[model samples]
Every structure is written in structure tokens, then in C-alpha cells.
Target: MKQWKLGLVVVLGISGLFSGRAIAAEEIILRYGILERTVAVSDLSQLAETGEATSQLQSYFDTAEVPAEEVQNMLNSDVTVDGVNINRILDNPLGDVLLDEVSKSIYPESGSAGRQAMRAALVLSAVDDDRITVIEVLENYPTSRVVLDTERLAETYEDFQEVGGVVVTVEDTLDDVLNVIRILETLSN
Candidate 1:
């Protein structure tokens, strides 16, 4: 009788373990740009809580195929105004956007200075743009909350000149870049 009880207990414990993994496999909705995707809840939770989750998201952005030539040129080149790196002038707030616009250009097809031109265009567009500013970032278990400074972002862009001569480095992985953009977009909305 004692042996039978022990065996039943072991079987139940094993079954519970498998069922727990099944529960974790449940799906959740995640939005990227205009696309909505159904991903495993476990995957989303891991991404929210762990820094290691970046590798998975990075693979998703690699599909854009920003040309190797453009990436190389931008990495080697410096953006300087009066011999100071443009990034030094901006002090980092707009660094991500500047880098993304320049490094991700499709190259030769876009023209000899397409990357630089694209970077310029992005800076110009941000002038009249009204995206919200992030105020607070919060993570609560499976849910995350981000508060924005809507009023400030609604004001006209007066800081464009600060980012005008910015230089970008492709030091970050493509996935990391995309992750930042997604997070910024999420907060802005």
C-alpha cells in the first residue's frame, strides 16, 4: 500500500510539471510597427523581465536588409561640426534616431550620400513631429505601463539644430536598434 501511494504521488508530480509548461505556452499579442503578432506568453514575459530576450527580437529586424555597404560607411565615418562629434553636441537623447536613419539606408540605390541624406530628412521631419515624451516606465509582472509627457511632445520641435550634424555608429546589434524603436514607439503612443 505504501509503495503504491508513493508511485501515485510521483506520477502526479510529473504530470503537474508538464501541465505547468503547457500553461506557459499560452499565446499573447504583441505589436510591432503596424503588425500584430501572437507570440507565446512565456516568450513575452521573458522579454519583459530579462535582458537576454534581445536576441529573439533582433532576429526579427534583420529582415529589413539595410545594406552592408551603408552600414560599413556610416560606422567608419564621423559626424562632426567644428571638429566635435555631432553626437557630443546632442548629448544622446536623439542619438538612436540619428543612427537608425543613417545606418539603415539601402545604399547605392538611395544615392551616394543617401544615408547622410536620410539622416538629414529624419532630423527635419522631427521638427514638426508631435510624438509624446516618456515620463515613467513601469513593469508589473505580465503587464507593463509607460507614462508620457504628452503636452511637451505636442509643442513644436525647436531642438532640431542640436541633432543636425550627428554621427552614428553601428556598435549596437540590429535587434537592439529595433528594440529601442519599438519601445520608443510604444511609449509615444
Candidate 2:
């Protein structure tokens, strides 16, 4: 039988992302080395909805050296994933690894809380429309201030690309383990 339940969850906890409501983030603090800038979450929402970049949001693209078009693609690119499966994947050790990588870029102001915050952002974002996007993640960021490191986004992007692989891998592992347990129980019986 297929393990359809393995598709979901992390620090802050996989449970936290799927359950409690997080305070919506107000602004995103874009950081690159010693330089830092802030863009209101509303600004991002407008851009995602209309494809128009406000001056403040455009400034961040210029400072981060990330192409505006590419960032926009990221902002709106939607990945369809079931909520329960996403929660399961994010709650595991491998999920923590993915969280750690992403949190490096998009996290709370405190920085240390990046892992859990990232988990919540992704889960809540996915919860919104049965899909998740970069903009959705930012909108659901579980803090007043969300930080994005423009320099570190490449790895985060790569990790996101692997979400499909992670889901498949987790399900396979669960099936294998469950099969072994069944065989061992049969032998004992």
C-alpha cells in the first residue's frame, strides 16, 4: 500500500506550522553583508498581485543584486502541495535540514529563530491556497520582521526544487520501514 500520509513538517516544530496561528509579518528586512533594507509586506503583496514593483521593493532588488524578473518569478511561482504531506516532510530531520538552509535566507530578525519561523512561514503559506510561493511564505512569516538574505537565496531556491524529491523519498522510506516491521512481526508470530 502507498503511504500517502508521509507528505507532511520542524523547529518552532512541524506541529506549530500546521496548527497555531502565527502573527503575520509586517515587513521584510532584506540584508546583504553589512547593508540592510526593509520592505513592507504589503509592498510585496501588491507586486505579486499586479506585477508592479514599488520603489522600495525595487530598491531591494537593486541592492541584493538579484534580478527583478527572477525575484518576481519566485514571488509568484506556486507549488501545489497537500497540507498534511507538507507538514510531515517539514517535521522530520531532513525537513529540519531544508528549514536550516532556507532560514539562512528568510528568517526572523533574531536570526536564531530562522528554522522554526521558516517552517511556520512555509506551512502557513501552503495552508492559504493549497499552494505555496515565495510571496506567500513572506506574507505568513511568523514574526513582526522577516529577514531575507539576498546572497543566500540560491541555496534556498535549490532546496525548494528538491521538495518533490523529498516527498518521494520520505514516502519510500516510510513504506520500507513499515514493511520490515510487518515481516518481523510475521516471523515472531
Query: What does the lDDT read for residue 37 in candidate 2?
Result: 87
Q: Which ten residues in a row have the lowest lDDT in candidate 2?
A: 1-10
For residue 92, model 2's alpha carbon misses the true position, in angstroms, by 1.9
Error of 2 at 42 (Å): 1.0
User: What is the lDDT, from 0 to 100, of the residue 171 in candidate 2?
Assistant: 68
lDDT to native, each model: 0.32, 0.74
Candidate with the greatest TM-score versus the true structure: 2
- Position 137, candidate 2: lDDT: 87
Candidate 1: 10-residue stretch with minimal lDDT = 132-141
- Candidate 1 on 35-144: residue-level lDDT in tens? 43444434434544442334444443344333333322322222223211222323354654544333332121213443333333232222222111111010111122
Best by lDDT: 2
- Give the Cα RMSD of candidate 2: 5.6
Collision count for each candidate, in order? 1, 14
Candidate 1 Cα deviation (angstroms), residue 71: 24
Error of 1 at 91 (Å): 44
